[model samples]
Target: MSGPVYFVSGIDTGIGKTFATGYLAKLWSEHGKKVITQKLIQTGNVDISEDIQQHREIMGMGWFPEDMTKLTMPEIFTYPASPHLATKIDAREIDFQKIADATLQLAEKYDVVLLEGAGGLMVPLTTELLTIDYIAQKKFPVILVSSGRLGSINHTLLSLEALKIRGLPLYALAYNLNDESQDAIISKDTSEYLKTYLAQNFPNAQWIDIPVVQHKDPLMD
Candidate 1:
Protein backbone atom coordinates (compact mmCIF):
# COMPACT_ATOMS: atom_id res chain seq x y z
CA MET A 1 0.00 0.00 0.00
CA SER A 2 1.09 3.61 -0.54
CA GLY A 3 2.21 5.83 2.30
CA PRO A 4 -0.52 7.31 4.50
CA VAL A 5 0.99 10.76 5.28
CA TYR A 6 2.07 13.85 3.36
CA PHE A 7 2.95 17.43 4.43
CA VAL A 8 0.46 19.61 2.65
CA SER A 9 1.41 23.32 3.01
CA GLY A 10 3.28 25.90 5.00
CA ILE A 11 1.92 29.15 6.49
CA ASP A 12 4.06 31.31 4.22
CA THR A 13 7.10 31.29 2.02
CA GLY A 14 10.49 30.59 3.65
CA ILE A 15 8.73 29.22 6.74
CA GLY A 16 10.98 26.14 6.90
CA LYS A 17 8.76 23.84 4.90
CA THR A 18 11.87 22.19 3.46
CA PHE A 19 13.58 21.92 6.81
CA ALA A 20 10.48 20.39 8.37
CA THR A 21 10.03 18.07 5.41
CA GLY A 22 13.67 16.97 5.68
CA TYR A 23 13.34 16.43 9.41
CA LEU A 24 10.20 14.37 9.01
CA ALA A 25 11.82 12.33 6.26
CA LYS A 26 14.86 11.77 8.43
CA LEU A 27 12.66 10.58 11.26
CA TRP A 28 10.96 8.06 9.04
CA SER A 29 14.29 6.99 7.61
CA GLU A 30 15.62 6.28 11.09
CA HIS A 31 12.65 4.02 11.59
CA GLY A 32 13.95 1.90 8.66
CA LYS A 33 11.30 3.07 6.29
CA LYS A 34 12.15 3.97 2.69
CA VAL A 35 11.53 7.67 3.02
CA ILE A 36 11.47 10.05 0.08
CA THR A 37 10.73 13.76 -0.46
CA GLN A 38 9.34 15.91 -3.24
CA LYS A 39 9.42 19.67 -3.87
CA LEU A 40 6.50 20.14 -6.10
CA ILE A 41 7.03 23.30 -8.20
CA GLN A 42 10.33 24.36 -6.70
CA THR A 43 11.04 28.02 -7.41
CA GLY A 44 14.26 30.01 -7.46
CA ASN A 45 16.31 26.90 -8.13
CA VAL A 46 19.67 28.31 -9.10
CA ASP A 47 21.65 25.08 -8.64
CA ILE A 48 19.33 23.09 -6.40
CA SER A 49 18.28 24.72 -3.13
CA GLU A 50 19.79 23.81 0.21
CA ASP A 51 16.56 22.10 1.23
CA ILE A 52 16.71 19.52 -1.58
CA GLN A 53 20.37 18.82 -0.89
CA GLN A 54 19.61 18.43 2.81
CA HIS A 55 17.08 15.73 2.05
CA ARG A 56 19.56 13.85 -0.15
CA GLU A 57 22.28 14.07 2.49
CA ILE A 58 19.89 12.93 5.20
CA MET A 59 19.06 9.88 3.13
CA GLY A 60 22.78 9.06 3.33
CA MET A 61 25.17 7.64 0.77
CA GLY A 62 23.79 4.97 -1.57
CA TRP A 63 20.66 4.73 0.58
CA PHE A 64 18.59 6.85 -1.79
CA PRO A 65 17.14 4.96 -4.72
CA GLU A 66 17.66 6.72 -8.06
CA ASP A 67 13.98 6.90 -8.75
CA MET A 68 13.38 8.80 -5.51
CA THR A 69 14.95 12.06 -6.65
CA LYS A 70 14.11 11.64 -10.32
CA LEU A 71 10.48 10.79 -9.77
CA THR A 72 9.89 13.14 -6.90
CA MET A 73 11.44 16.53 -7.76
CA PRO A 74 10.35 17.91 -11.10
CA GLU A 75 9.37 21.28 -12.57
CA ILE A 76 12.21 23.31 -11.13
CA PHE A 77 11.76 27.01 -11.85
CA THR A 78 14.37 29.74 -11.48
CA TYR A 79 12.18 32.77 -10.80
CA PRO A 80 11.49 33.07 -7.10
CA ALA A 81 7.80 33.76 -7.29
CA SER A 82 4.49 32.00 -7.28
CA PRO A 83 4.20 29.22 -9.83
CA HIS A 84 1.79 31.27 -11.86
CA LEU A 85 4.15 34.27 -11.91
CA ALA A 86 7.34 32.27 -12.20
CA THR A 87 6.02 30.07 -15.00
CA LYS A 88 4.74 33.09 -16.84
CA ILE A 89 8.12 34.79 -16.64
CA ASP A 90 9.77 31.62 -17.87
CA ALA A 91 7.14 31.32 -20.61
CA ARG A 92 5.79 28.04 -19.29
CA GLU A 93 2.69 26.71 -17.58
CA ILE A 94 2.48 24.98 -14.21
CA ASP A 95 1.75 21.37 -15.02
CA PHE A 96 0.23 20.41 -11.70
CA GLN A 97 -1.06 17.13 -13.08
CA LYS A 98 2.52 16.08 -13.69
CA ILE A 99 3.39 16.93 -10.09
CA ALA A 100 0.45 14.93 -8.77
CA ASP A 101 1.34 11.93 -10.91
CA ALA A 102 4.99 12.01 -9.89
CA THR A 103 4.13 12.22 -6.20
CA LEU A 104 1.78 9.24 -6.46
CA GLN A 105 4.45 7.23 -8.24
CA LEU A 106 6.93 7.95 -5.46
CA ALA A 107 4.33 7.03 -2.83
CA GLU A 108 3.75 3.76 -4.64
CA LYS A 109 7.42 2.94 -4.33
CA TYR A 110 8.56 4.42 -1.04
CA ASP A 111 7.25 3.79 2.45
CA VAL A 112 6.73 7.52 2.98
CA VAL A 113 6.77 10.56 0.73
CA LEU A 114 7.08 14.05 2.17
CA LEU A 115 5.58 16.30 -0.46
CA GLU A 116 6.46 19.96 0.12
CA GLY A 117 4.32 22.72 -1.30
CA ALA A 118 5.85 25.76 -3.02
CA GLY A 119 4.30 28.49 -0.89
CA GLY A 120 1.38 29.19 1.42
CA LEU A 121 -1.73 27.01 1.35
CA MET A 122 -3.72 29.40 -0.83
CA VAL A 123 -0.93 30.17 -3.28
CA PRO A 124 -2.18 29.71 -6.77
CA LEU A 125 -0.91 26.78 -8.76
CA THR A 126 -2.94 27.75 -11.80
CA THR A 127 -5.52 30.31 -12.74
CA GLU A 128 -8.29 28.51 -10.89
CA LEU A 129 -6.63 26.12 -8.38
CA LEU A 130 -4.64 26.75 -5.24
CA THR A 131 -2.00 24.56 -3.58
CA ILE A 132 -4.43 23.49 -0.84
CA ASP A 133 -6.90 22.39 -3.48
CA TYR A 134 -4.28 20.08 -4.90
CA ILE A 135 -3.61 18.66 -1.46
CA ALA A 136 -7.31 18.09 -0.88
CA GLN A 137 -7.63 16.37 -4.21
CA LYS A 138 -4.67 14.17 -3.41
CA LYS A 139 -6.41 13.36 -0.12
CA PHE A 140 -3.20 13.62 1.87
CA PRO A 141 -3.32 14.48 5.57
CA VAL A 142 -1.90 18.00 5.90
CA ILE A 143 0.71 19.23 8.36
CA LEU A 144 0.93 23.03 8.29
CA VAL A 145 4.31 24.53 9.11
CA SER A 146 3.97 27.95 10.69
CA SER A 147 6.35 30.38 12.35
CA GLY A 148 6.20 32.37 15.58
CA ARG A 149 6.05 35.91 14.26
CA LEU A 150 3.93 39.00 13.96
CA GLY A 151 0.54 38.38 12.38
CA SER A 152 1.09 34.62 12.64
CA ILE A 153 -2.17 34.26 14.46
CA ASN A 154 -4.15 35.77 11.62
CA HIS A 155 -2.15 33.91 8.95
CA THR A 156 -2.49 30.57 10.73
CA LEU A 157 -6.18 31.10 11.36
CA LEU A 158 -6.83 32.08 7.76
CA SER A 159 -4.87 29.10 6.47
CA LEU A 160 -6.76 26.80 8.81
CA GLU A 161 -10.02 28.28 7.65
CA ALA A 162 -9.09 27.81 3.99
CA LEU A 163 -8.31 24.16 4.61
CA LYS A 164 -11.54 23.73 6.51
CA ILE A 165 -13.49 25.28 3.65
CA ARG A 166 -11.81 22.88 1.25
CA GLY A 167 -12.75 20.01 3.59
CA LEU A 168 -9.17 18.81 3.87
CA PRO A 169 -7.91 16.51 6.60
CA LEU A 170 -5.48 18.55 8.65
CA TYR A 171 -3.21 16.18 10.49
CA ALA A 172 -1.42 18.71 12.68
CA LEU A 173 -0.12 22.27 13.00
CA ALA A 174 3.62 22.68 13.43
CA TYR A 175 4.45 26.10 14.86
CA ASN A 176 8.10 26.43 13.99
CA LEU A 177 9.97 28.94 16.12
CA ASN A 178 12.10 30.44 13.41
CA ASP A 179 11.98 34.02 14.51
CA GLU A 180 12.74 34.02 18.23
CA SER A 181 12.56 37.78 18.62
CA GLN A 182 9.87 39.17 16.43
CA ASP A 183 7.59 40.88 18.92
CA ALA A 184 7.49 40.01 22.59
CA ILE A 185 3.86 38.99 22.57
CA ILE A 186 4.01 37.16 19.26
CA SER A 187 7.21 35.33 20.02
CA LYS A 188 5.86 34.32 23.40
CA ASP A 189 2.17 33.58 23.01
CA THR A 190 1.55 32.61 19.40
CA SER A 191 2.14 28.94 19.86
CA GLU A 192 0.14 28.57 23.05
CA TYR A 193 -2.71 30.68 21.75
CA LEU A 194 -2.84 28.86 18.42
CA LYS A 195 -2.69 25.49 20.09
CA THR A 196 -5.61 26.36 22.36
CA TYR A 197 -7.59 27.99 19.56
CA LEU A 198 -7.04 25.13 17.14
CA ALA A 199 -7.91 22.59 19.78
CA GLN A 200 -11.20 24.37 20.24
CA ASN A 201 -11.96 24.87 16.56
CA PHE A 202 -10.20 22.02 14.84
CA PRO A 203 -10.23 19.34 17.49
CA ASN A 204 -8.52 16.82 15.27
CA ALA A 205 -5.45 18.98 14.73
CA GLN A 206 -2.40 18.68 17.02
CA TRP A 207 0.30 21.32 17.63
CA ILE A 208 3.96 20.41 17.27
CA ASP A 209 6.93 22.61 18.18
CA ILE A 210 9.74 22.85 15.64
CA PRO A 211 12.64 24.80 17.05
CA VAL A 212 14.75 26.81 14.68
CA VAL A 213 18.25 25.44 14.28
CA GLN A 214 21.42 26.35 12.46
CA HIS A 215 23.04 24.20 9.73
CA LYS A 216 19.68 22.78 8.75
CA ASP A 217 19.57 20.27 11.55
CA PRO A 218 16.58 18.07 12.28
CA LEU A 219 13.86 19.29 14.67
CA MET A 220 15.15 17.38 17.64
CA ASP A 221 14.00 19.06 20.83
Candidate 2:
Protein backbone atom coordinates (compact mmCIF):
# COMPACT_ATOMS: atom_id res chain seq x y z
CA MET A 1 0.00 0.00 0.00
CA SER A 2 0.94 3.65 -0.42
CA GLY A 3 2.84 5.20 2.47
CA PRO A 4 1.20 8.11 4.24
CA VAL A 5 1.58 7.29 7.90
CA TYR A 6 0.61 10.09 10.25
CA PHE A 7 1.77 9.81 13.84
CA VAL A 8 -0.97 11.49 15.86
CA SER A 9 -0.07 12.81 19.29
CA GLY A 10 -1.53 15.50 21.53
CA ILE A 11 -0.22 18.36 23.58
CA ASP A 12 -1.91 16.60 26.45
CA THR A 13 -4.27 13.72 27.07
CA GLY A 14 -8.02 14.19 26.37
CA ILE A 15 -7.13 16.71 23.67
CA GLY A 16 -9.03 14.75 20.99
CA LYS A 17 -6.13 12.88 19.38
CA THR A 18 -8.07 9.63 19.20
CA PHE A 19 -11.20 11.33 17.86
CA ALA A 20 -9.22 13.35 15.38
CA THR A 21 -7.42 10.21 14.22
CA GLY A 22 -10.79 8.56 13.54
CA TYR A 23 -12.11 11.65 11.78
CA LEU A 24 -9.09 11.68 9.48
CA ALA A 25 -9.47 7.99 8.80
CA LYS A 26 -13.13 8.49 7.90
CA LEU A 27 -12.22 11.31 5.56
CA TRP A 28 -9.61 9.22 3.77
CA SER A 29 -12.00 6.27 3.52
CA GLU A 30 -14.66 8.54 2.05
CA HIS A 31 -12.17 9.50 -0.64
CA GLY A 32 -11.83 5.81 -1.58
CA LYS A 33 -8.58 5.22 0.21
CA LYS A 34 -7.75 2.11 2.21
CA VAL A 35 -7.27 3.72 5.60
CA ILE A 36 -6.28 2.02 8.84
CA THR A 37 -5.52 3.31 12.35
CA GLN A 38 -2.84 2.22 14.82
CA LYS A 39 -2.59 3.00 18.46
CA LEU A 40 0.59 1.55 19.95
CA ILE A 41 -0.79 1.15 23.44
CA GLN A 42 -4.31 1.62 24.79
CA THR A 43 -4.88 1.94 28.49
CA GLY A 44 -7.84 2.46 30.87
CA ASN A 45 -10.19 0.21 28.93
CA VAL A 46 -10.14 -3.38 30.17
CA ASP A 47 -12.26 -5.21 27.63
CA ILE A 48 -11.53 -3.28 24.47
CA SER A 49 -9.25 -0.69 22.94
CA GLU A 50 -11.31 2.46 23.50
CA ASP A 51 -9.42 4.60 20.97
CA ILE A 52 -9.77 2.14 18.10
CA GLN A 53 -13.37 1.40 19.12
CA GLN A 54 -14.24 5.10 18.85
CA HIS A 55 -12.34 5.30 15.56
CA ARG A 56 -14.27 2.38 14.10
CA GLU A 57 -17.55 3.62 15.51
CA ILE A 58 -17.05 7.01 13.87
CA MET A 59 -15.71 5.55 10.65
CA GLY A 60 -19.06 3.71 10.57
CA MET A 61 -19.31 0.32 8.83
CA GLY A 62 -17.39 -1.56 6.14
CA TRP A 63 -14.36 0.69 6.30
CA PHE A 64 -12.34 -2.11 7.80
CA PRO A 65 -12.19 -5.38 5.89
CA GLU A 66 -11.45 -7.52 8.93
CA ASP A 67 -10.78 -7.19 12.66
CA MET A 68 -8.41 -4.20 12.54
CA THR A 69 -8.00 -3.54 16.25
CA LYS A 70 -5.74 -6.53 16.79
CA LEU A 71 -3.48 -5.37 13.96
CA THR A 72 -3.49 -1.74 14.99
CA MET A 73 -2.99 -1.76 18.73
CA PRO A 74 -0.95 -4.84 19.52
CA GLU A 75 -0.09 -3.70 23.04
CA ILE A 76 -2.74 -2.75 25.55
CA PHE A 77 -3.25 -2.81 29.28
CA THR A 78 -6.05 -2.35 31.80
CA TYR A 79 -4.43 0.36 33.88
CA PRO A 80 -5.40 3.93 33.14
CA ALA A 81 -1.93 5.41 33.16
CA SER A 82 1.22 5.94 31.14
CA PRO A 83 2.53 2.98 29.15
CA HIS A 84 5.41 2.45 31.56
CA LEU A 85 3.25 2.62 34.67
CA ALA A 86 0.40 0.77 33.04
CA THR A 87 2.66 -2.15 32.06
CA LYS A 88 4.15 -2.04 35.53
CA ILE A 89 0.68 -2.31 36.97
CA ASP A 90 0.06 -5.35 34.79
CA ALA A 91 3.40 -6.86 35.91
CA ARG A 92 4.80 -6.77 32.40
CA GLU A 93 7.13 -4.71 30.26
CA ILE A 94 6.91 -2.92 26.93
CA ASP A 95 9.20 -4.41 24.31
CA PHE A 96 10.34 -1.56 22.11
CA GLN A 97 11.49 -3.80 19.29
CA LYS A 98 8.18 -5.65 19.31
CA ILE A 99 6.22 -2.40 19.04
CA ALA A 100 8.56 -1.11 16.34
CA ASP A 101 8.19 -4.32 14.35
CA ALA A 102 4.40 -4.29 14.62
CA THR A 103 4.28 -0.69 13.47
CA LEU A 104 6.46 -1.47 10.46
CA GLN A 105 4.29 -4.45 9.53
CA LEU A 106 1.09 -2.39 9.58
CA ALA A 107 2.60 0.35 7.42
CA GLU A 108 3.00 -2.22 4.65
CA LYS A 109 -0.71 -3.13 4.61
CA TYR A 110 -2.70 0.10 4.18
CA ASP A 111 -2.83 3.13 1.92
CA VAL A 112 -2.77 5.47 4.87
CA VAL A 113 -1.93 4.59 8.47
CA LEU A 114 -3.11 6.85 11.30
CA LEU A 115 -0.84 6.00 14.22
CA GLU A 116 -2.16 7.57 17.40
CA GLY A 117 0.01 7.77 20.48
CA ALA A 118 -1.12 7.63 24.09
CA GLY A 119 -1.14 10.67 26.39
CA GLY A 120 1.17 13.48 25.24
CA LEU A 121 4.35 13.63 23.19
CA MET A 122 6.42 13.32 26.32
CA VAL A 123 4.46 10.40 27.72
CA PRO A 124 6.83 7.48 28.18
CA LEU A 125 6.30 4.53 25.88
CA THR A 126 8.67 2.58 28.11
CA THR A 127 11.07 3.56 30.88
CA GLU A 128 13.35 5.27 28.34
CA LEU A 129 11.27 5.63 25.18
CA LEU A 130 8.96 8.63 25.04
CA THR A 131 6.07 9.00 22.60
CA ILE A 132 8.16 11.48 20.61
CA ASP A 133 10.92 8.91 20.46
CA TYR A 134 8.66 6.57 18.53
CA ILE A 135 7.69 9.32 16.12
CA ALA A 136 11.29 10.27 15.61
CA GLN A 137 12.28 6.67 15.06
CA LYS A 138 9.52 6.02 12.54
CA LYS A 139 9.95 9.45 10.91
CA PHE A 140 6.21 9.77 10.27
CA PRO A 141 4.62 13.15 9.78
CA VAL A 142 3.27 14.40 13.10
CA ILE A 143 -0.35 15.41 13.69
CA LEU A 144 -0.50 17.34 16.92
CA VAL A 145 -3.94 17.58 18.49
CA SER A 146 -4.53 20.39 20.96
CA SER A 147 -7.47 21.08 23.22
CA GLY A 148 -8.89 24.47 22.33
CA ARG A 149 -9.41 25.40 25.95
CA LEU A 150 -7.91 27.79 28.45
CA GLY A 151 -4.10 27.65 28.70
CA SER A 152 -3.85 25.92 25.34
CA ILE A 153 -1.22 28.34 24.12
CA ASN A 154 1.29 27.21 26.69
CA HIS A 155 0.64 23.53 26.12
CA THR A 156 0.53 23.68 22.32
CA LEU A 157 3.60 25.91 22.08
CA LEU A 158 5.57 23.60 24.30
CA SER A 159 4.68 20.65 22.12
CA LEU A 160 5.52 22.53 18.95
CA GLU A 161 8.90 23.47 20.36
CA ALA A 162 9.73 19.87 21.09
CA LEU A 163 8.74 18.77 17.58
CA LYS A 164 10.95 21.50 16.18
CA ILE A 165 13.85 20.22 18.23
CA ARG A 166 13.33 16.79 16.73
CA GLY A 167 12.82 18.29 13.26
CA LEU A 168 9.41 16.64 12.93
CA PRO A 169 6.83 17.98 10.47
CA LEU A 170 3.58 18.60 12.32
CA TYR A 171 -0.03 19.17 11.25
CA ALA A 172 -1.88 20.67 14.17
CA LEU A 173 -5.61 20.48 14.94
CA ALA A 174 -7.39 22.15 17.83
CA TYR A 175 -10.70 20.76 19.05
CA ASN A 176 -12.84 20.40 22.13
CA LEU A 177 -13.44 16.77 23.07
CA ASN A 178 -15.56 15.26 25.84
CA ASP A 179 -18.84 16.59 27.25
CA GLU A 180 -19.46 20.15 26.11
CA SER A 181 -22.96 20.16 27.56
CA GLN A 182 -21.83 21.43 30.93
CA ASP A 183 -20.70 25.01 31.48
CA ALA A 184 -16.99 24.54 31.39
CA ILE A 185 -14.09 26.99 31.33
CA ILE A 186 -13.44 26.51 27.63
CA SER A 187 -11.96 29.12 25.38
CA LYS A 188 -14.16 29.67 22.37
CA ASP A 189 -11.51 31.71 20.55
CA THR A 190 -8.60 29.46 21.35
CA SER A 191 -8.79 27.54 18.10
CA GLU A 192 -8.65 30.62 15.95
CA TYR A 193 -6.04 32.17 18.18
CA LEU A 194 -3.89 29.08 17.92
CA LYS A 195 -4.11 29.04 14.14
CA THR A 196 -3.12 32.67 13.95
CA TYR A 197 -0.33 32.20 16.45
CA LEU A 198 1.12 29.26 14.57
CA ALA A 199 0.92 31.15 11.30
CA GLN A 200 2.72 34.13 12.73
CA ASN A 201 5.34 32.25 14.72
CA PHE A 202 5.74 28.96 12.84
CA PRO A 203 4.44 29.93 9.43
CA ASN A 204 5.02 26.52 7.85
CA ALA A 205 3.13 24.56 10.50
CA GLN A 206 -0.51 23.75 9.69
CA TRP A 207 -3.22 24.44 12.27
CA ILE A 208 -6.87 23.49 11.78
CA ASP A 209 -10.14 23.51 13.69
CA ILE A 210 -12.13 20.29 13.99
CA PRO A 211 -15.82 20.93 14.65
CA VAL A 212 -16.88 19.62 18.03
CA VAL A 213 -18.85 16.39 17.84
CA GLN A 214 -21.78 16.17 20.18
CA HIS A 215 -22.23 13.32 22.64
CA LYS A 216 -24.33 11.50 20.09
CA ASP A 217 -23.19 12.32 16.60
CA PRO A 218 -26.03 11.83 14.09
CA LEU A 219 -23.59 10.97 11.33
CA MET A 220 -22.04 8.15 13.35
CA ASP A 221 -25.39 6.95 14.68
| Highest-scoring model, TM-score | 1
> Model 1 segments beyond 4 Å from truth?
46-50, 58-63, 67-69, 182-185, 216-221
Report the lDDT tens digits of candidate 1 across residue range 112-155: 87877888888987778888877877778888988777777888
* lDDT of candidate 2 over 1-221, digit per residue (tens): 25678888887766677778888888779999988887778887775577787888878854354245466767779899999899989998876676666666667877888888898899997888888988898788888877655677688889988988998887655454541323354565665667777788677766655566766443221
- Pairing residues by index, what is the TM-score of model 1? 0.86
Q: Using alpha carbons, what is the TM-score of model 2?
A: 0.85
Q: In the order shown, what is each candidate's alpha-carbon RMSD?
A: 3.2, 3.5
TM-score of each: 0.86, 0.85
The residue pairs found clashing in candidate 1 are none
Report the Cα lDDT for residue 113, model 2: 85
